[model samples]
Target chain A: MPQTHDDVAETTPARADVVEMVGLHGFVQLAAFARLATDAEHAPDLRAQVTISRMAAGELAALDQLETVARRVGADLYEAMASYSTVLADFDRRTPPGDWWERVVRTYVAYGVLADLQRVLSRAVAPDGRPMLDDVIADSGYEDFVVAMLGPVVAADQQLSARLALWGRRVVGEALGIAQRLLAEHPLLWSFADRQDGARSEGDDAAWLRKQLSGGHARRMGRLGLTA
Target chain B: MPQTHDDVAETTPARADVVEMVGLHGFVQLAAFARLATDAEHAPDLRAQVTISRMAAGELAALDQLETVARRVGADLYEAMASYSTVLADFDRRTPPGDWWERVVRTYVAYGVLADLQRVLSRAVAPDGRPMLDDVIADSGYEDFVVAMLGPVVAADQQLSARLALWGRRVVGEALGIAQRLLAEHPLLWSFADRQDGARSEGDDAAWLRKQLSGGHARRMGRLGLTA
Candidate 1:
């Protein structure tokens, strides 16, 4: 059994493990965001989004020998990374954007939804892993930035809010579409998700994920000062 | 008036400065590469090049924070980074590749030359900066990977070398093409480039850059086991 973060309250695993895991996840997430940013041609205001994402990616590789260990653990962390990667790849392949705001909105939809899911999932990992996950979540400034960006646009134009709300809904829909496929195809990750609730049935985890997404959608809408 | 790395010897300032400059440069370089990786259709082995480039980008971002501080002390340093970044952005925009090998050759031609230039330029920076530059250069791992990927293709099909040679020539042409525009537009960078040779003219720098490109082209050809 992996030691939970709460278990070693006094001394952390020398801070190195936290650094390593956080760094790896950070890299994966950032690269995912960078891919989204490319598609966010409509969101020129969010060009910095990709830059931040790339920074996250670089951090993962910088974790000394931790990256090697992450791979060796058979966690398939890299594969897990590539799995999420397809979300962005699909976005790139199907719809290369012509406008800036569309690009930003797409990014806001894709990365924002994924980040929220990871934020919650990180909590279910083992204790030692929890700290690392916490660190990863902590470093991701995407949530705050997205909310900030959405605030003004919604405040100025109610139509923008409505359109973005619909966009957000579609984003979640597409994301869930992908998640369902991933769950079916990747039994280990599905098992991991199932173990999050100590439930034997995957249905329990699926229900839990649905509730989280609904809540997330509500929070995102509120952030935009819109009605979901 | 800037402190040379040698002047600082093996003391903290020397090491700290070297690391800082290199770290920032690395960060910018990685970010630039990630942007390029998104254009992987232009590369020969899309998946591998993208993976390597993304890894390099992430590693650059994860360097110690102390290093970031050291590199930001002078506007000159930032300016050099910005100049390189501009070159990258232009390359990205003008010649977005539709094929994989073209992208690989572009990476080889672009980063390969920049790495070589960095190797030489690091010597001119303060002695404290050299080690950090060296560290980044060592960690990049791109050159070896590129050579390995290029080797098999070259040995089995001489046409691969010929095509890549042509591609390499185009990258240099585009890079120098942009450099000329930058020289005309950014007098500050041009002046700095001249100062490197103790009052060499801007024209002199252009001449030197051409010579550097010529030599790099030859080296790349040799690595591909081709006659230049």
Candidate 2:
């Protein structure tokens, strides 16, 4: 993990890069927590929040612990997390809560997009390192939870399908907007995208992301008793 | 795990109690996220947060997934997680940011105390149910991380020793503050506390908590290069 380039970088250290990355992870972790907190609110009662909080706390602790390990392993852990976070934070900061549908769409679409990207990125890691990445991906029970939550509501009301479908489109638009920012900032990640099998063109990654979003939205809408 | 109560008072459904417990878990999870976010700020560079976030996310997801399983198994997962979260959240929401020492101390002492309690409570469950409790308790890596974080900080800064010791005391006060609220809200938890080690009185439970806090604080302080 301790490559010569990393050692040289540590010595001459682009301080601004370091700061930016830390800021990014901070923003992203905050967004993650906010999402968790908001989701917990939908729980049946305060007890549910407590339960969710403990789970969330453990996450926080694990993040800190992993950062410590990354430091030992000579990788810039903060920068990696921050790269993702910066995009998310900016999105949240720009998009004020418009309505419940908007919020729900954001959760479903935004996370779904990120998770797809992560799933791809996780594959790039060495085989041994994949376990941790898999673990992170595994914990995103949000999709299932969202489906369960919406199932009842959708069953009761048919009109929600049309409304959410529109909301899903807007959510996809916002996601693509942020993703462009992410690509511009992270050359390594962009390079990885370029190296992908079918993503040889400049806008290929964006197109692929859109396709994923479309597919995910369609699946979720149908699950919620909606027509895409 | 659902006990049939012949007495009418015991049989009455306690919705409020359930809510309070769940809320507590939410609080703890939020605080944990906050603390992790803050700790991420101390990372040497940006990439560190990425690693940390991955770890944190995994831990959080695990906790949440486990709770979902507990819910399926009729173990009131929300209530259990909430009980822990309530104390943590109250501490986070009320505590000033200047109290960094106290924050670390609380992480060290508070988690250890809870883990010990979990160890005892794990026994109360029947053999079939004990494994899940054991898995949750076992997966908590707080002690290792705390030791790692505090070891160098304490060794390098002598002034931090006295400051952290006092901070440890304050953390206990904060814990007690939330503990009282929890006890008032959840008689089941209190009863669980009392039944542990055949203790029957509230005073006894308080004493046990105090002793645990003091010992945990001492151990953590020692790790932080302080004289316990």
Candidate 3:
């Protein structure tokens, strides 16, 4: 984390850019919670329903902490959050899940890639930004839960796994598209990635800085007996 | 709350029925959260959006506590909760909201009436039951939020108030029907209400043990500049 405005200004993201990154992180969390909460509602198995609902609650708590950080840094949470609502909404409309299994794979795959993206942005942000990201990006935490719940089913049914492998590919493609658009719109946050990683990758590639970001989702999908 | 099985058996609801009541309560909390979380999603005003999302989170927390009580009493939470899912789902299907204001009023009116019904059932159940009910029934707490948020808007627009007034009545009407059906189905739990309140009007009217139950909503509606 950068210590001073001048130092951060010279290398990492500036204060305003940090605030914007925090807000964008909040939007990601709010969007995930809203979508998973719906999945939880339609989940017929009470165990799955309750577990997903609890996961959704965890996402909201992460958003609340980020909002607190945003306010502390003189950012209007709503203003910061609403700034990128359409970016996520467009992704949602384009990748609407066709069935319960699709919904499960969608949440499982999309959350992984987005959380990983949030983590990378955290590395590039100012001091306060890291904690906000830290709360959301517990590496492989959500992945473990979704896999344990869905992997057994996917393993038992060859047909379901084959169908979901395709769905998983589609979800990641759109997720990456939104990830690129967000980084493109906020290039200052992109600079933080370059400064932190010491990579000379183009701004568009800022979102994919470490192959490790996409690796987590692909590995989780593989665990589920589906292609990434 | 009743301490011993025999003591609870003598006058209050049996352990099984008490467990059923707890599960039914869980369904109520879960359904409210599911509905309001969607309301939070559609709420365009960010302040209202976050506040409703927070309120939705509170409903889930209340559900979690009841689930704890249910499990402590050896109730399979899923079985207990699923028993009443259709009852609430049917209520939801019948009274779909027309717009955002209707959505807000629907939550406000429906939650008030149902929580009051849960409170009355608590009075008659075994000893451990009251606390579960108490957590969900904080006495017009949610109403305060709705009134403050919508009261002025209703006061300013005669057409919106009239429209919402109709919507509010419909929501309460359906809410009361489901509340009545639940009491009718679990007549043993209804007996707990009579025993605790010392009122012998009728088992069918068990849900209406006290006028104060419905009064909360009617009064809150008046405060919101709508006819209850």
Candidate 4:
């Protein structure tokens, strides 16, 4: 157990499950980037469209690093990601975005939750994997670009601002539901995080995670001048 | 007009049409890149998928330089591209891809012809704009990647090989038809290309361009061990 709240405090011996966890994270990245690229097609202006596309390229560049991590661990990158494709895709199919605005909101909100989950999983990884996971999650790089781009656009139109706020709230609801379901499916990943939080019981840790997820969204929405 | 076979022999003073021509080329690059990113979604395997996505990123990178060219000429990039959007989209809507293979083939063949057309227009740009156009056309950087990635895959399956070759033929036909229509609609662009070829009549120049396009495809198909 960690004497202090630091991922490096515990030398958790990573096993096969770490490979699957990383693979799922890699796939999540692929989905996020692909969505950005697709949404660029519908952007209202050329600058907006091209900027979004370039941001997507940045996201894909990060995916390349995740792949590098998989290779270092001797995991077949494709096999690592293949299993989680359905559950992730199903989450999307179940709560399909109605339009470009809804889609963007979903990605923004859900990625925040997903990144939090990945962070929880990070402490459970062997120290070698932690740095890679840390770099990937610190995806604060593009999150800033997205927020900057969206903030002014959303501020410019009162009706659009209101609609996005509502859409964002709905997205958080769907994301919360999906996260709960994901924990049930990925028990090994959950167990890793659970073990890392030895100070708290399983229920306590789960509740804390849910709080982090929602709390993160509320803060992000607030930043965008919207309520979660 | 050039006294020799070079684009820079005479300073053909570029005017408003230069902006529109560059804008159309930018839009074409955008379409080509967007198509790559989309086709990546249906790639047969993970390596193929990730590689295609990265290649799309490369194509997008090339677009950034085109935008730079747009800015240099004081072209409102969005408005410059807007008028031609309908015609471009119409060509796409009329000949939508049946599957991933068809879509890839369309981008490959159509892009070759489009690149050839742009090179002709590149000769017409003011010497300052010509270098940007040249760099963007030399987008041979990723074109080689597509051929390398695709060649082995096509060669592996006899049926796929035959289908792709036939599909390539169909794409060239559609592309040639589109190219002819595009010339009729944008007389200013064609006139520049016409004047650049001082020795050839307009009909002869058009015939030579078509030969270059098809000839390019035939050789590419040969490299892939498929009949163009």
Candidate 5:
């Protein structure tokens, strides 16, 4: 469960949990992308793809901070993270990429959605934790790489564009579903959702997050020459 | 075909080809190890393991040099590399590691052999190309990480040590077999062996390389509490 509070002292440990969960998830996602970037068949530019992955590894610096925070608060980082594997793994399982184009779209779309959510959620974290979160999500490093690699292929094949656009929507759908499940299962997240500055309801947060996710996804699709 | 020469000017392009072949092979080996490092099941420490993989990625810096060299000479880097793929892929196919310990041992042993051979062969390259080749092989970053990870595990289980030692030998066998195939198929390499300074024969270089490979493997086994 991940929750954030304005009164930082009282909810310090939970905030740390929130950060660890986000940071660990980011690392896991980036690591998977790093592996996929090595797929010579599907990757647009192996060098640029690898570059994006190394940049993704840059997020590990923030992961270090979150892990430290988790330790200081006596949180069992692994135990706290155990619940996430199911949802995250489910997202991967449901939307397995069949080839290189699918890989590019899935990576670009899913990571974009997660990055967007992390950006919105970072505001709820305590001040110390927020900056690092911001840094992790700040640079969408692979966006141009995806466009450059996949754009031409999509332009050449109408069938691929349609398939990829559908793939992009599926990723957004799956990611949002996981986020919803995450919010529901974790009390910390529920509190974070419920206890934000004003009386914004969970539905409102979900809607806002969804808007951001779709906006990002649409822009990414546009970049890759796939219609939203 | 990639060949080296004492006469620097005429053979400059061939020297570059030779460097690209070796550099690209090293990059491919490192890239494969990078993927294996992400396997949490066998890796002793995920963070340290990933660090080693990233260090492996650092080998790509030499890859950039090789690409430059290949382009300057109008050599198709991939085309020149096509012949060696069989041997390289065969090595991987035959010596797949089943667990984390095996992964560490295989990666360390196989990479050590390649790095050692690269070190020996780098001497034949023109002066300008030698430094980058040397830099790529110099650190052996993952060796320390493997010893730190596997030493205690093997100490706890004698049977594991025995298994790893056997595994180490198999990796060496497969690697040497690949090298033989690579030398036989590539004229540049045959020339490299045949046309080196008149005093030495191909048998001498091969024997010297074998000694270095075996000695390094034996020492690594001892470090890991395994009998050579």
Candidate 6:
């Protein structure tokens, strides 16, 4: 969903802001990874916990590289990050994990949705930022971690599966709510929505984003034995 | 603080447990890094925040390597992790960061002391785990980040400096308290203290640990422009 507007190359300042937003998302990934790494009760299996933590740590390293990309393009990393912190923090507050299983599901679903957005943003942004964004997107190695942990849990516990299915939906709801809030507040981000839809209105952009995010969320939930 | 006891080579199971402890500490590092990476308000300065987070992330990578070493020595990573979780969590809870500055100081000081302990433990454990421990200890790169952030803050603000100096002392106090408790609860951890002190009493081991940790803490504090 990339726009090949030649002027896109000239928009480094704005694109840098977008790169910082990606970095901010990197922090979110780091936070989720940290939660998984330290959730002792839910993650009783040390091997699994370590495995997940390493994956999360790998994401942070990728974010570190992305920050470097932002700096090279003259992005005000702190200012860009500050603008979106409240929306993300609120989203996290509304979607606190209930248990170990819920934590894994949340990590899986949230990253999946964010990766979809990143995939679009990586393409819509300036080319310099594109490669870094691509690397950051490719760092979505949590799929194996999620399947290994949740596949068996869902198979064994039908009641737990039902609960998690509902939980997964709530996560999607909260995430979309946050995504909508982000788009509404940061009209700049709407550029991604617009470029993807070829000069669409904000309303259409929101609808498109919802469809895009929800479709990905449904596929991810199905994989995890949860109803979207 | 290493002893040259030849018997140190024969304790593979015990050594394996120690390696797992290293992995658990890696999670502690991961958790702390995640908190800093996500602490939007306190970490207002993006450069310092990202710098410290990168350091913490690096520690997790080192721990991943250490886990491989543990496996090589037949250590049960999860069991070892479970046993030490309480001690590390208690240390973290009691020394909770009051603000962003406290967060940085806490990470710097705890890791410094742990590196020292790991230096001793790495040698005391089997040779298989020694090289990994050496790498883990060598990964203590927060020194520059701490100096860069705290040095200026302390140089500019005397009141803040005094507050953080005292805070640094409290972090050390809480950390040593946890170390002593671990030594008491897990008699095996006492082996490190014992190897250093030639069968000294618990009181003496505690004193030695205090001395060791305090000396390193003072050096770190001085470097950061905080009072020892």
Top candidate when judged by TM-score against the true structure: 3
**Residue-level lDDT for A37 in candidate 5:** 38
Question: Judged by DockQ cut-offs, is candidate 5 incorrect, acceptable, medium or high?
Answer: incorrect
Clashing pairs in 5: A2-A188, A2-A189, A3-A188, B42-B100
- Residue A219 local lDDT, model 6: 84
- The numbered model that scores best in DockQ is 3
The whole-model lDDT of each prediction reads 0.51, 0.51, 0.71, 0.69, 0.58, 0.62
DockQ of candidate 2? 0.16
State the lDDT of candidate 5 residue by residue for A85-173, as single tens digits: 55655777798889877866777777777665565555444645542233544464567766776789889999988998888888878
Estimate, for each residue in B1-228, the C-alpha lDDT of model 3 and write its tens digit: 213234333344227776677777778777777877888888968667777776776777666556555655666767887777788778878988888888888888888877777766665344555333454544425678888878989989999999998898888878877777776676666644634345556752644444656687788788897887
Per residue, candidate 2 scores C-alpha lDDT tens digits across B63-147 of 4534443443445555555455435555666655455455556666665555454433333232233322224444445566666
Ranking of all candidate structures by their TM-score, best first: 3, 4, 6, 5, 1, 2
DockQ of each candidate relative to the true complex? 0.17, 0.16, 0.64, 0.56, 0.21, 0.31
Q: Tell me the spans in candidate 2 whose CA falls farther than 4 Å from its real position.
A: A1-85, A96-102, A116-142, A154-167, A186-228, B1-76, B79-88, B99-102, B119-136, B158-163, B180-205, B226-228
Q: What's the C-alpha lDDT at position A15 in model 2?
A: 39
Interface RMSD values, listed in order for every candidate: 5.8, 5.8, 1.2, 1.3, 4.9, 4.3
Model 6: per-residue Cα lDDT over A1-228, one tens digit each = 212233444456546446546545555554454444444225656566556656655655565555554565566555555556566567668888888788777767777877677665554445554433445555546776677778888989999999999888888788778767766766665544424337457677778788888888888888877777
Kindly list the per-residue Cα lDDT of model 1 for residues A126-196, writing each as its tens digit: 44544322344434455567668667877899777677666666666776665555445444443234223
Model 4: share of true interface contacts reproduced: 0.59
Q: For model 5, give the TM-score of chain B.
A: 0.75
Q: Give me the candidate number with maximum lDDT.
A: 3
* Cα lDDT for residue B113, candidate 1: 61
lDDT of 5 by residue, B1-228 (tens): 122233443345556446445534545543543444344323444455346645544544454444555554556555555445445556767887888778778777777766655554554345554332335444646778778877898888988878888988888888766555555455354333323445266677566556766787778778777877
For residues B124-218, could you state the per-residue lDDT of candidate 1 as single tens digits? 24333443223444445666676797678778887776776677677777765754554454443332231345636767777776676568767
Which stretches of model 6 miss by more than 4 angstroms? A1-42, A68-72, A125-133, A190-199, B1-42, B125-133, B189-203
